[model samples]
Target: NATFGMGAISITSEREKDVDFTLGVMTTGVNLLISKPKIMDSIFQFMEPFSLNLWMAIVGASVGVSILYFVLDYPSEERKFSARETWWFSVGTLLMRGTDFAPRPSSQRILTAGFLFFVLITVSSYTANMAAFLTTNNLEKQIQSLEELVERSDFQCGTVKDSATMNFFKTSSKPIYRKVWSKMSEGGLVSGSKEGRERVRAGGYAFIFDYMINSYSELTSCETKMVGTPFRLQEHGIAMKQGASIKSILNINLLKIKESPIMTQLQTKWWENKRKCDFIESQPTVEFGIKHMAGVFIVGAGGLVCAILFFLSKKWFVAVRTKEKSAESDTGLEETLYTTDKTMSKEDIANAVKV
Candidate 1:
């Protein structure tokens, strides 16, 4: 009688001596299983799109460009303004809330136009990145490779005892695999894949098992995920006693079935159709939160402060100049009156002497 089962049943050299293995029914490999990462809450999560250094660079660029604009548009006596006014105008232009004054010189106008173009490009890029950052899930992966799994000490790793994956690790010649095998032999190995999966779901534990089963388990449970790329490439084959005549016929038919559309339909029916979890890959809804637009409000507040200071300084300068002019006019008028009195007195004395 032919024996067939849907377990791992890999066609290794050791197993080939006792039983015949038909063509691979399913291709799979060992994969790491861990709990799904939780979404972290951060107050400054909105600033995640750009690094601190990048943000600093942007600010530096704006300041440098503003200085360039001020130098290019230096004012004349007819359209005079303080250094502060020129700075304010340049900053306002950079922010796209342009100032009342426009550059009169061709060189200044050209520079201003170039700066506007730069601002346009920068603003567009920032907006697009911010939108993506707010709407997309950028979860940090806990483990990405076998090397990482070995390096991390926060979680204990395990696999089903006497399974194909366990045997692969135990027989491997590589130092990393040898180390993993030692750990597994000590206390990590579990009796069944189900127990290993349950340990993973409980957290602080990692399970190494067949990729196909891991994929199926992830679809069934929402809180568990298959992490990292597969380590050992292996195939599942139908098992039969050695020297079985039906092996050749079964292999031929298996190849035919694989080539047909029936295999794909069966795979879809088993994997996709039976998924228990409601997994949707839709864009996350983004709301206009204060954190998202904090920079805009901050810039507006800065401009308002600058405007207030500029108004006060202008008023103070005008007041001081007006006071100095009044003082000079009063002194000149007094001198003129004294000169007229002296001339009138001298004229009256001369007329009296002649008479």
Candidate 2:
């Protein structure tokens, strides 16, 4: 009687010609193994939530709305003000600070109310989006398929030499598989799965292998990940010499084992409970440092400085105008007094002559 051996032996036509394979015990495929992508740190990462064009549009909208409010709130001739006051009123309203001058006309009041409503909506939406963006993590670009792996030149691809995975790539007629095989052959193939996996962990490389093996590797390695869906559907079966008498008996036992709870217990013991790496979903939200809000604070400081300069210039101009007016009034009064005294002297002299 021939002996039967069972393992992850793939059922292939060439192998079948040499040995008889029992019915498939498990089905799996080949997948790409790669290092987990690292999240990149950026100095201006806070601005990533919105695009440059969107940010520009928001600024433009704020200024446009402010200008509109200024035009609508223009005072009448009796209570007239310089154009500067109108602009200040509009900007103050935009900033949610009530302006010194209240809107008097009904039309002006209505327009100001509508603009405030718009501001409320815009600010609320921005706050909500910003919060979400800050709390959530940004994902790095990932390789999702074999075609992407072949097209990208950044990652070197390889597999264990003389392995099933290597054979699959070497014999594949597809252009992507052919390209991958060419690159791997040129770069030199890995000796075994361990070396291939180590290459992936070191980064800048991707290893192709059986999905089952890759899954087990990911459980044990923290920085390793299995990416892309499996391909080349392969079935694992028991292999025995051709015309082996025990093949029928072994197939029957394999079917029974698959249907029983023993299979589930075995898989759980190996894949889950034996995991070596801690599962991490996301890190804590980073607190915003001075650098994060530096732009906002700088802009505010600039506006305050400009306002102070404008106020000082306006005060100086008013003072100069007031002094000139007072001097002119004094000169006119002195000339009038002198002219009156001369007229009185002439009248008195004429009276004396008549006497």
Instruction: State the C-alpha lDDT per candidate.
Output: 0.70, 0.71
Candidate 2 global lDDT: 0.71
Put down candidate 2 lDDT per residue, 13-41, tens digits, no spaces. 87888889998978999999888755436
Give lDDT tens digits, candidate 1, residues 6-47: 466887888888788899987888888887754435798766
* Candidate 2 regions with alpha-carbon error over 4 angstroms: 1-5, 38-140, 278-355
Off by over 4 Å in 1: 38-141, 278-355
Give the C-alpha lDDT of model 1: 0.70
In candidate 2, list every pair of residues with a backbone clash. none
For candidate 2, the per-residue lDDT at 275 reads 96
What is the Å distance of residue 70 in model 1 from its true position? 50
